[model samples]
Structure formats: structure tokens, C-alpha cells
Target chain A: MSRVIQIAGLRYRYPDGTQALDGIDFHLNSGESVALFGANGSGKTTFVLHLNGLLRGEGSIEICGMRLADGTLEQIRSKVGVVFQDSDEQLFMPTVLEDVAFGPLNLGLSPDDALTRARTVLKRVGMAHAFERAPYHLSAGEKKRVAIAGVLAMDPEILVLDEPTTFLDPPTRRDLLSLLRSLPQAKVVVTHDANLARALTSRAVFFDQGRITGQGDVIEIIQRFHWEYS
Target chain B: MHHLVIDRWSRGSSSLHQRDPRAKLAALLVFLVVLSTTRPGAQWAFVAYAVLLILTANLARLPILGLASRAALVLPFSATFALLTWWSGDSLRALALAEKSFLSGTAALLLVGTTPLTGWTAALESWRVPRMLILVIQFVYRYLFVIAEQVQRMRWAALCRGPKQRGFRLAAGLVGVLFARSWQRADGIYHAMLARGFRGRFVPAPPAPFRSSDALFLSTCLAGCLAIRMLL
Candidate 1:
């Protein structure tokens, strides 16, 4: 498989001197799905943020063979779609259609085309009925679907989902997992759900205090980290 | 919750709601200017303005009572100044002061109540309003509910801990924590925007074409307001 993302010696420090990410190396092949397992504040989120140039750390990073630099930032962003854990943060437009259209509109698509793409993706995510609904008015599951639709509307090559199932209930989580599995793009999922990781990803990477502690088969990594409770 | 009601009202399919936003905005400006300049003693003009607003609200299919009550939100502020004027021995002027403020508020509400936020905001953009100011308005409107919900949850959590939590001290602490949480949310929102390839300015949706009916609507409003100013 061809490499879709490559990073070397990645390190990031917040303004308050917190070493959020420290010398991390990671890679994801095209069409591959990987799960990131870590305790809260273990730098999984920070690492994925660098994949799309949202959080630039001191490192050499590449997305779809394009260097993550100033000139290539926009292009790289269009290649790596990040669905934030909080759907509220991502779905900021007044209506569902507009929120989903936001990314396509940003990519210089004409309004009509963007709206068309948004509608198509919303339909794909089973949120076609919510086209005119306010994002805040939707239930958590619906909001999550719309959030995914928003990212999907961008037609990115790689999907970086940060806690995609954060607030979803059992049936909603099952629906989400199925919807996610249907997408064709490679994925980097930052999650804590062991079953989710096992079901959705072939490989897993564990982070500890801003560094990778283990990387292997999904079940192996989960077992090594004692990531699940009986 | 009032805004939510208005939001729902704005999405209705009445003739008044179908009027172009630019026409509605211009009509609002003309109404406000005419009402503001009407002499304080012209009680008939004030009555006419109220009738006009009521007629328009009915035409828009909005709940007249809801619109009136929401518009009365401005009265408390105007009543303070009206009280001063009344104490200064000009009760008519005091009444007109309150009248002008209420009429103006209702007229403005009529515009927004009929036109969705995007419609009017896009109208403002077409008029060459400062992009920065429009951006601020859009962002605040979009996130106001999210922040309000957060505050509600925080308040509930505090109340759950103890009944004595309903005081200025608790409010102050909530405000502080809210400020910090809002800050973090803002950061997350900005990052999300970046992830979607937002380059400084928002990509505006294409503006709707202004039709001849919209022109006629604006003309009717202009004539009505001016005639009221001269005759009443």
C-alpha cells in the first residue's frame, strides 16, 4: 500500500510549556484504518491535528506526498478531513445544509455545487431530513451524522476522526460504525473504545505521556495496554 | 428561546417572509427614520405606525402577541428614560419616547422575524457593510445557543450541589468558568474551521436576485412611511 501520511520526530509544545506531543513517528497507508489508544492528554489528539496542518509542530510531516508547509497547507487540508470530537464545534453554520456545504464552499466550489454535494452527503449519512434544521436542535446522534456529512462533503482522501462516537448511545454508535466503515478513505481514529477500535481498525497505536508506547495488531495493542475492562 | 421562536417564524412561507431581504432591510430603515423624526406630540402617527406594524405582522403570519411581547423587551430601557422625562413634567414626550422605542423595536423585529438570519446578513453584505462586523454578528448568532446551553448545564450542576448556590458568588464563578470554557470552545471551533480549509473570510453563498416585486414592496413601504410622516 502507498503511504497516505508520514511523520518523523514530531514535537509540539503549548504556549504554557506543556509538552503536548514529543518526538512521535507515525504513518498510515492509503485505504488503511488505524486506531489511536491513549489516556486523556496522552497526545493522540495533538498527533492527529498535525496530519492536516491544524496544529503545526516541529516536525517533518507529509500528507498524500505533499509536505505540510505554508504553501501546501490548503491542499493538505483538503486531503485530510478532521471530524472533531465535539460536533457542535464542527457544525457552526446556521442550518445543516449550510454547515455541510461549508467545507466544499471553502474549497472554491460554486455555491450550487457545494449545496448539491452537501445534500448528497447528508443523504448518505441519513440526515437528508435535517437539511433545514438547526445544528443545536438535532439530537446527539443526528448531530454526529451531520458532522460526518460536513467532513465528507469536502471529499478528503484521509479522514481523521477524534472520538467520533463520543456521546452516541448503543444503537447510534452501531449506526455510526457502519456508516464509517462504508466510507472509502483511509482513517486515523483517536478513540478509547476497545470494541470500536477492534471492529473498525486493523492496527492500533498506543500513546503514553506524549509518545508512542506500542504499535501492532488492534487486539494485541489493546491487550498489551490493558485497555478494556471486563 | 425568544430567538428560537423568531427563527422558526423566519422560516415560514408567508408573502412578507418571501419578500427579498434587501427590500425588508430598506423598509425597516425607512420606518425607523420616519418614526424617530415624528414629533413627540403626534399621537396619531404613533397609532398609525402601530397599525402598520400589526398589519405587517399579520401579513407575515407571525403571532402578533409573541411579536409584541418580544418587542416590549426594549420598553424597560426606554421606560427608565421616559420616567425621567415624565418627572421633568412632559408626560406626552415620555409616552412618545416609549412609543418610538417600542415601534422601532417592533419594526426591526418584523424584518428579522420574516427574513432568516442568512438572508438579512447577506443583504447587509451586499450593502458593503464591514466584513469584520458582519463576521462577528454571524459568529455570535451561530454560537449563542451553544454557549447558552453550556451555561444552563453549569447552572444546573451548581444547583444540584446545593440550593444556596443561587447567588452572586456562584454567578461570578460561573461567569469565570464560562469565559474559560468559551475560550477553549472557540479555540476548538477555529481549529475545526482550519481543518475544513477556511481561509480568513467565510465563503459567502451566492446572493439571491432582487425581483421587481421586491422593488414594489420597498416602494410601498417608502410611500406609506412618508405619507404617515406628512399626514399624521
Candidate 2:
């Protein structure tokens, strides 16, 4: 299987001298899903941010065989769709349809084509009825669906979902989990939900103090890191 | 909440709402100019301006009383200047000052109440407004609801401690915290945008074609306002 992402010797430090990421090596095969397990401030997010060039650090990273560089940044971004932890941040357009169309429009699709693609993905996410509704007016689950639709409209090859199930009720989380599992793209899920990790990902990587400490089966990593509350 | 009401009103199907945003924008400019230049003591002109706004609101199928109450929000600010003029013995100008401000607010509200944010913002873009300024306006309009909700949640959390805990200190502290949160939220939003191939500029949707009917609408509005200013 071809690898969609490859990273080596990745290191990052904030402007305030805080070391956020240290010597990380990671890879994801096409059609594979991995769970990223880490405590707050352990560099899980900073590491993923590097995959799309949102945060640049001294690292060797390749997305879809293209090196992460200024010239390839835009193309790399189109390949790696990051669903942020907060749906509020991801869905900023005035209406749900427009928000979903945002990524496609940014990809240079004509407005008519963008809207059509938006409708298709919104339907895929089961949010077809809310095309005209404002993002703020949606419930937590609905917002997440629209956020996913927005990213999906870009037709990205790999998905990076950060805390996708946050702030959702049990039923909503269940629905979102199913919706996510049904997508065909390779995914790297940054989450605290052990059940979600087990259900959606076959492999897992554990991070501690800005480095990957362990990687193996999902259950093994969870047990090694003591990542669950109960 | 004010924006919520206007947003709902803007979605309603009416002839006035169906008129193009550029047309409404053009009419608003004409009304403002005519109203502002009227003689201070020409009470009849003020009355005629109010009537014109009322007629427009009626045609738009909006609630006149609700619009008037919301537009009255500008009164306290304008009343300050009006009171100074009244104290200086220029009662005519004071009355006119209050009248103009109220009419202006109502007229502005009429345009917004009939046109969606996308429509008006697109109109501004088509008029060659600075891209940065239009972007700022769009972001502010989009996030105001989120900020308002956060403020309410913070207020509730504060009130849970004790009803009597409210004071200037508490208010100031709330504002500070809100400011910090907003900054963080803005950063997250920017990152999200970047993650989706945002290249530092927003690509607007295809422009809605302005029809000849819209031009007729604009001409009629300008002519009516001019006639009111000249003859009344």
C-alpha cells in the first residue's frame, strides 16, 4: 500500500521557547486509519499542524509524495483535510451551503460547480436539509457534519480529524462515528475517546512530552498509556 | 438578538426584499443625502421622510413598530448632541438633529432588513470597497452570534456564584476574558482557513446579475426622495 503521509525528525518550538514537538516520526498508508493519543500540550495538534504546513518546524514531511514546502503548500493543503476540534472555527461562512462550498471555491471550482459539490457532500453527511441554515443555529452534531462536508467538498485524499466528537451527546457521537467510518479516505484521528479509537482505527500512536513514545495495536497503545477514564 | 431579528426579516419573500441589494444600497444613499440637507426648521420635510420610511417598510412586509423600536437604539447617542444644541438656544437644530438621526437609523435598518449579509456585502464588493475592509465586516458579522453566546454563558457562570456579585469590576473582568477568548478563537479560525487551502484572500461567489427592473427600482426611489426634499 502506498503511504499518504511520511514524517521524519519533526521538531517544533513556540515563539515563547516552549518545545511543542520533538523528533517525531509518523506514517499513514493509503486507506488506513490511526489514532493519535496524547495529553494536552503533548504536541499531538502541533504535529498534525505540520502535515498541512499550518505550523512550520524543522522537519521532513511528505503529503501524497509531495514535500511540504512553500511551492507545494497549497497542493498539500488540498490533500490533507483537517477537521478542527471546534466546529465553530471550521464553519465560518454565512450559510451551511456556503460554508461547505468554501473549500471547493478555494480550490478554484466555479460557483455553480462548488454549490453542486457542496450539496452532494452535505447529503453524504446527512445535512442536506440545512443548506440555508446558519452555522450558529445548528446543534453540535449538525455543525460537525457541516464541517466535515466543508472539508469533503474539497475532495481531499487524507483526513485529519482533531477531537471530532467533542461537545456531542452520546447519540450524536454515535452518528458522527458512523458517518466518519463510512468515508473512504485514510484518516488520522486525534481523540481521547478510546472506544472511538478502537472502532475507527486499527493502529494507534501515543505521545508524551512532545515525542511519540509508542505505536502498535489500538488496544495496546491505549493500555500502555492508560488513556481512558473508566 | 438584534441581528437575529433582522436576519429573519431579510429571509422573508417580499417585493422590496426581492429588489437587488445594489438598488437598495443606492436608494439608501439618496435618502441619507436628502434627509441630511433638509432645512433644520422644515418640520414638514422630517414628517415626509418618516412617511417615506414607513411606506418602504410596509412595502417590504416588515413590522414597522419592531423596526422603529430597534432603530430608536441610536437615539440616546444622538440625544447627547441634541441636548447640547438645545442648551445653546438652537432648539430648531436640536429637533432636527434628533429627527435626522432617527430617520437615518430607520432607513439603514430598512436596507439591512430586506437584504441578506451576502447580498449587501457582495454589493459592497462590487462597488470596489477595499477587500480587507469587506473581509473584516464579513468576519465580524459572522462571529457576532458566537461572541454573544459566549458572553451569555460567561454571564451565567458568574451569576451562579451569587446574584449580588455583579459590579463594575466583574464587568471589566468579563470584558477582558472575552477579549482574550476572542483572540484565541480568531487564531483557531485562521488556522482552519489555512488548513483548507485558504491563500490569504477570499474568493467571492459569482455575482448576481443586476436586472433592468432593479435599475427602475433605484431610479424611482431616488426620484421620490428628491421630490420629497424639493417640494415638501
Candidate 3:
């Protein structure tokens, strides 16, 4: 299987000298979905931030076989789309359509083409009705969908979603899961919800103290780690 | 939440709303210039300006009372200067100070009410307004709702825990927390932008072509205001 993402000896230290990520090794195969399970501050976010070169540290990272570096950061960014946990943070444009088009436009698509792609992706995510709606007026679920559509509009090869279901109700989560499942890109989901990991990801990797402690089938990892609360 | 009312107002289909933002912005500049330069004690000019704004507000289909009340928000600030002017014995200038500020505020609100935030900001960009300033304005406008909601939720939580009279201390604490939250939120927003291939600048959607209709609208507004400024 072709590897979409590969990292070795990944390490990151905050300005305050705390090691956020330490000597990590990971890989994601093409068309595979993996769940990143860890407690808060277990370097899950910091690691994902590295995938797009948003937070660089001591690491050798490659996306689709291209080594990540300053010169290739922009190209890597377009290849690994990240959906932030907070939809408010993700959807900053005045209108939903503009917000969705933001990524495509930034990727250098012509304005007409970007907008057309944005509308198409918005429809794909069932947000076409809110094309002109101010993003602030959307409900949490709707905002998350728009956020995903914004990333999808870039036509990225991989999606890194950090708590995509944070504020969603059960129905919304189900809908989001289905929408996510329909997408063809490889995915790395940082989640605390074991059921979500099981439902959406084929494999799971557990993190503790900035190190991967285990990697295996989703149900086995969840069961071994007791990831769910009664 | 109250600002949402204006946001909704901007989405309307009135003739004024349909005018290009550049035209509306140009007209607004002219109105401000004429209003600001009017001679002291030119009560008739001020009257004409107020009437013009009211008529424009009517054309935009915005509720007159709502627009007036929201515009009155500027009064407390201007009223201070107006009061000092009155105390120093320039009652005419004082009254004009108050009237000018109110009318100015109303005119500005008309522009925002008629044009969506993106529309007006994009117009500002076309006029060569600094990209950083436009970016800041867009972010502030977009996050105002998010921050306001945070404030509301915090207020509710504070109320749930204690007496409302002790809100001063609660408010102080709220401000600190809100600042920290806003900082974190801004960081997240920047990261999200970066992850999506943003390289410092927002790629503005292609602006609609500026048409003769827009120019005609600006001309009519300018002539009408100029006529009122001189002829009134």
C-alpha cells in the first residue's frame, strides 16, 4: 500500500521548554482512516499540526512522498486539510459560500472556479441552502459541515479532523459521520470518543506522554485502553 | 445578539441594498464631508441632512426607529463634547455637535445596513485600503457574534451562581477570561487559516463589475447631497 503520510523522529518543544511531542514515528496508508486516541495534551494536536507543517519541529515528514520543508509547506498544506475542533474558528468568512471558497481561492484557483467548487462541495455537505448565510447565524452542526466543506473545497488528499463532533448533537454526529465516510480521502481523526473512532476509523493509535503506546484494530485498542466512560 | 438584527437587515433586497458597495461607500463619504463642513447654526442644512438620511433609511426598508436607536449609541460620546460646548456658551455649535454626530452615525449605519460586511470591505479593498486593516475589520466583524455569545453565556453562568448585584467583580473576572479565550480563539483561527493554504492574505472573491448603474446611483446621491448642502 502506498503511504500517504510518513513521519520519523518527530519532536516538538514549546517556547516554555515543555516537550509536546517526543521522538514519534507514524505512517498513514492511502485511503486508510486512523483514529488518534489520547488524553488532552498528549501531543495529538501538536502531531497533527506537523502533518501540514503548521507547527514545525525536529521531524522528517513526507506527504505523498514529497519531503516537507519550508519550500514545500504550501504544497503540503493543500494536500492535508485540517478541520479544527471549533467550527467558529474554521468558518471565519462573512458568508458560508465565501468561507468554503476560502481554501480553494487560497490554492490559486480563479475566483469563478473557486466559487463553483465551493458551491459544489457545499452541496455535497448539504449546506447549499446556507450559501449566503452569515456563518455566525448557523447552528453548531451546520457550522461544522461548512468547515468540512471549506477543507474539502481544497480537494485535499488527506483530512485531519480535530474533534469534528465537539458541539454536535447525536443526530448531527451521525450525519457528520456519514458525510465523512462518504469522502474518499485518508483521514486522521483526533478524538476521545471510542465509539466514534470505532465507527469511523479502521485502526487506532493511542498516545501517552507524547509517545504512541499501541496501534491495532479500533475495537481492540478501545477495549485495551478502556477509552469509553460508563 | 442585537447586532444580528443589522446583519439581517443588510441581507434585504431594497434598491439601496442592491446598489454596489463602492457606490454606497462613495455616497457615504460625500454625505460625511458635506455634513461635517456645514456652518455652525446652519440648522436648515442639518435638517436637510437628517431628512435625507431618514429618506434613505426608508428606501433601504430598515425600521426607522430601530436605526435611529442604534445610531443613538454614538450620542453618549458626542453628548459629552456637546455638553462642554454648551457650558462654554456655544449652544448652537453644541446642538450641531450632537446633531452632526447623530446624523453621521445614522449615515454610517445606512451604509452597513444596505451592504453586507464582505461587500463593503471588498469595496474598501478596491479603494486600496490596507489589506491588513481590511483583514482586521473582517475578523472583528465575523467574531463579534462569537465573542458576544461567549459573554452572554458567561453572564448566565455568573447569574446562576450568585446575586446579580455582585456583577462588578464577576464582570472583571469575565473580562480577563474573555481576553484569554479570545487570544486562544484567534490562534485557532490563524492555524485553521494556515492549514487551508492561507499565506498571509485573504483571496478576495472576484468583485462584481462596477456598472454605470452604480455610478449613476453615486451621482444621484452626490448631486442630491450637494444640492442640499448648497441650495438648502
Worst 10 residues of 2 chain A by lDDT: A128-137
Q: What is the C-alpha lDDT of each candidate?
A: 0.91, 0.92, 0.91
Candidate 3's residue-wise lDDT over A1-230, tens digit each? 89999999999999999999989999999999999999999999999989999899997999999999989999999999999898888888889998998898888999999999999999999998999999888999999999999999989999999988887899988999999999999999999998888888999999999999999999999999999977
Model 2 segments more than 4 A misplaced: B40-44, B79-94, B155-176
Query: Better model by TM-score, 1 or 2?
Result: 1
Give the DockQ (2 decimals) of all models: 0.76, 0.72, 0.76
- The C-alpha stretches of model 3 lying farther than 4 A from their native spots are B40-45, B77-94, B155-174
Question: Cα-based RMSD of the predictions, in order?
Answer: 2.2, 2.5, 2.6
Calculate model 1's interface RMSD in Å.
1.1
Summarize candidate 2's per-residue lDDT along A157-190 as a digit string, tens digits: 9999998998999999999999999999999999
lDDT of 1 at A230: 67
Q: How high is each candidate's interface RMSD, in Å? A: 1.1, 1.0, 1.0
- Tens-digit lDDT track for model 1 on A20-52? 998999999999999999999999988888888
